[model samples]
Target: MGCKSCGSGTNEDGTPKGCGSKGACNTSSCNQRSTYDWLSDLGIDDPYAASIVEVSFKNGASKDFYYAPSELEVFTGDNVAVETKNGYNVGRITLSGELVRLQMKKKKVREEKVTESIIRRANTRDMERLAEVRDMERSTLVKARAIARSNHSKMKITDVEFQGDGKKATIYYTCDERVDFRELVRQFSHQFRIKIEMRQIGPRQESARLGGIGSCGRELCCSTWLSDFSSVNTAAARYQNIAINQAKLSGQCGRLKCCLNYELDTYMEALEVFPKKADKLRTEAGLAILIKTDIFKGIMYYTYKENRGLLYPIPVAKVHEILAMNKAGDKPIDLQSNQLVVEEKDDVFGYEDVTGAIELPAEKRRKKRRKKKSGTNAKGRSSGSGRKPASGDSRAKTGEAKTSNTGDKPAAGGETKEGSRSSKRRRGRSNNRNKKRGENASAGPKASSGGGDKPANKPSTPKPTGEGGKGGSSSSGRKKRTPRRKKRGGDAPKGD
Candidate 1:
């Protein structure tokens, strides 16, 4: 297997064997920033190529210029062991040949400052060690964070990197202000038992190093291709008519989104076409003031100074004409016009028309009316018990009616002087009707007969005990009630 940076290596049998489809995939990915060597692919070799090679560490997290040996022939995607002051580090070669010279010059890195050089190409053993160190980076980061915490250092550890030989580690941290590094480094070095590097970076740089998807649903520009970060301000949003909402306007860096400045120049150019000194227009109806501008549509929206609820859109040419008319001592009738109305699309395609179609019946609860307090009538007697009397008791019903007609007061000890009888137990409506009929029949005979005299057909009061259909001694607590006989026409009172 070889580094498949160029995607153009071969096998011994003359068949393609590199990272292409013709061969088995032996791609040891080294390309992170996606660079292509145009000269190498074209089979062109420059006689005056730079000796300095650009090596990327941590898959393009960082890049440093290293002097390449004249004798060593580096291939695409080749991993090289570079010389650091502490130990050797492994990195992939991203740039070589004269292009590297141009990169160095563009970065303004002087050749004399380039002190380190490539020792040799990464062999099997070096790669194995490189993998081992890379695996330890996560654990190393956790331990470094713990160490920094133990030291009470005011810094956030973002990432950790280990040398190929595992002899040194670089800890990337972020801090707002200067920190006391002497104590932190002493503790870290003793704890890890290796050379400790405290590298500081900004919040944006931290996000760039640790790549992630952005709010735009794509890879971060910083991690993908954007290398330079410039200042962004709210003026960019204002020029484009965007709302000044902090949450939507800011990116993951807690700063104004870089995309805000992408089309800012175009917006600025468009804004220049808007007329100046046209914030107000004098009219006979009232004074109208400019509210906003539609740069592309060439419309300027204005509102009456007294009525801001309605907006009137006037063409740029019409606005200029009005300004000229005003300058010539003339005034328009009013700001309102047919063009002031902005038509909005009434039909939305994606959503279902569910308005008033789905009805949910509201739950209705019947409120129980409060029962009026029962009290005695004008006479000093209880109308009924604390509840409703039996339906057959005609006397009790009459008393209750009289009690209600008069303002009854409560009796002593009882809940009220006369509590109206609400049904104490459940009873059938038929039973109540039958009881009322019996009460009517019994009342008719009683009313016809004389008041004090007993009726002839009525049964007499029982003696001590009546049995065997004859008057006799009664049994104790076991006597059965006799059924009432129906009244006959012959038994009717003579008065009727």
Candidate 2:
């Protein structure tokens, strides 16, 4: 028989012997052992060997593969040979029986098609060779891009993954359209001695591969559960009333975000009860267009012609009533005329001419003129009283004559009385008095009336003007006086 991993010789009972190549031979059966045949062949019933539960197909049933009881412990990331319907195909152990069953249920695979038997386990040499292939992937990418650039291809080199056997590497790239990467694959295989596969992806898949947090603060759905990308359009924006210019409404793809459609049905349902702005309504004076409406507020503004053709505001409820009346073929009542505010009329008798007719202007004039005329009359009355009285004039004239008559008489009488009394007293005192004591007389030696007397020496007085003891005016004796008017230098000679 042919070996599953490397196409080499097999043992009897259709079991694979050792594989042919380095990565190819690690999982081969070193000893040919069927299910439940390990302990007996080893010559000891050692209980340390774990019993094999099942063998699982890693890549599914296009290849023939199997694993032995001891190889059941092989996990994912461990390269293993899995038995398929035909030849053995090798894949990493991505899942076991229970998980594979679930995956089968998810993929709806038939129960008989699933392989649940192990062949053998991976050894050290297999792991080391896989690491060698991983180490080669980085350098292979640089050479691949250079090859693509030489061919003038617009394809991008995103990532490279080597198969477990080191026979093939898959290259992921993004391009605007289909790319002919046949030359790139040829160059890669020639340079690296391996098969090459190119995979194309979109911006969303590129974002998922790079891994990012979305605007909603979560891992991208494409990286999580979303394997399919649906087309998002701006129509979703119109349905949700989202402003088309808002950056949040656009996603990293520069298109309307997919989340806008998530709640569109709810908004559409809410919009059903709203009134459209297309309807027209009439008013008493003129027509008004329906501009906008607040649905929740149940209010709308209507414009109608008023003074000077300017539109005035009215409510929607009022417009609806008017529209209803118009539909009923009845003209709307002019509430503006009927509801005019009528002022109460005043009694003519009680109304004191506020308009200030005939006598009013005169009355105002009289009020202004009264102050002047009264002030003039008061000035005239006061001026009449302030005039000197004729009695006062007569008394002033008579008192002037009396003052002239009494002026000499009072002077002569006072002089006669003073002279007579002084002369009589002087005679009486001279007749009754004795000589004063010498000490008393001498105590005031400079007296005028006592016996001891001496005349005080006096300075000569200045002579008076034009009198018995005065002199004729001299240049130095005249008082200095200022002239009343300035003396003119010259005058026009008798008015020319």
Candidate 3:
């Protein structure tokens, strides 16, 4: 959205950085290459604010001035219906107030000649109908081309625009030779059931009507704000010291880009300071022919027959002195001896590469993974977990790990370690609760279940952690361990 045309993109916010049309940033503010209304922000109430206003139709493909009725309020970017030759057409206000007078004067359009009056601001119904009418253009274009091709017409129908009321349509086209579209128009009227306008235009105008992205990666200026297409020639490139690349110079219209003439005047003014017809110079190193010129630098590069690949850059003043000397029957020592030293800068893409060594995070991660796998693959694996004490760690490592391993162990009390901790009391009264639960379990029916036949003080042995443990060995004064469920989908995939 940071494009220049998107300056007046929003209704009240400050100008956006870009014209949204450059990409698919179809914001509401980007009303088909709208110009930002900077004057409106001045907040000065002009007496002639509601004069004739310039309106943009079809997203600026065409524009016309409409007289703004003093009774009605109007502003730039307002959608208003204006009078047409046949019916009312909808267009957005682009220029109004005092600016309209300046534009009219520039275009030499008489204010009295602007007879069309603004009918009214388009309402909801009118906006909806306008959308429906525009949606028909895509399919209409396809059908239009088919009808023309069936009639064996050589012209290509570039675009189709329907009237606001949907009672008439205009078909724009381009052709090299004259075409008889009388029969084509008759078929169009019968099929479309409306008035048909067959408008013939040149290639440039055709491209302007149906806009496209230019080679410069922007919307065609003709479709945006470029109302006129000036003739461009190869001379503009030569004057600016540009290579005459036809493919690069050509535009979407298959002609030289109109932008070629944008800075042509500036190049012309700069070239006024350069000496013309100074292509060759007689020197001791042989005849030096002009190779290239740095126009802004006022330096000209030349190559001699003796040094074919090498080039010597000479200033304009020095070239003139040598030319005057040659005219007086004198030759300089050599073009190189009098050449200006052009400093070569090693710059690339606005950035420079500094050579140094640094470690890549990805490589470091890979090395860490290799170290982790090597460390984990080595056994006892259980000791690294720091779970059991120093001596019991070796015994725990012999066990094949379960899918779900418990971090908590059973306390001396009948209650398991997980069930015994009662929130903060465990932090404040840990020993008291364990001792109390043990005393209670030892005194009651839990006591009968605790030691039933064997005595409670006997030390217990570490049973095998897997499948062979006994289920009926509750006589060991310890809770019977329940077998863990096998993992779903059989064994899990191997890597951690």
What ordering of candidates by TM-score runs from best to worst? 3, 1, 2
C-alpha lDDT of residue 148 in model 1:
79
lDDT of 3 by residue, 249-317 (tens): 988889989988988888898788777778889987699999889888889999996678888889999
Model 3 alpha-carbon miss at residue 479, Å = 76
Winning candidate number (TM-score): 3
TM-score of each: 0.63, 0.39, 0.64
lDDT at 465, model 3:
35
Residue 4 CA displacement from its true place in model 1, Å: 6.8
Worst 10 residues of 1 by lDDT: 441-450
- Give Cα distance to truth, residue 487, candidate 1, Å: 18
lDDT of 3 at 449: 16
lDDT at position 111, candidate 1: 92
Q: Please give, for residues 1-496, the per-residue lDDT of candidate 1 as tens digits.
A: 3333334456766534543222222332344443545555545667888888888887778889999988987744567899998779988777778778777777899999999999998887997898888899998788888887887888999998888899998889999999989888888898888998889998888888887878989877777667568889998898899999999998887778888989998888887867789999999878999888899888999889998998888988888888898999999888775244567999878988897899889899999855432333223332233343444332334354323334533222232222232321111122223334332221111111123232222222223334453322234434222223234554633321
Candidate 2 lDDT over 81-162, as tens digits, reads 4443333334444333343444455556665654555555655565466567668878877888888898899998866766
- Roughly what TM-score does model 2 have, to 2 decimal places? 0.39
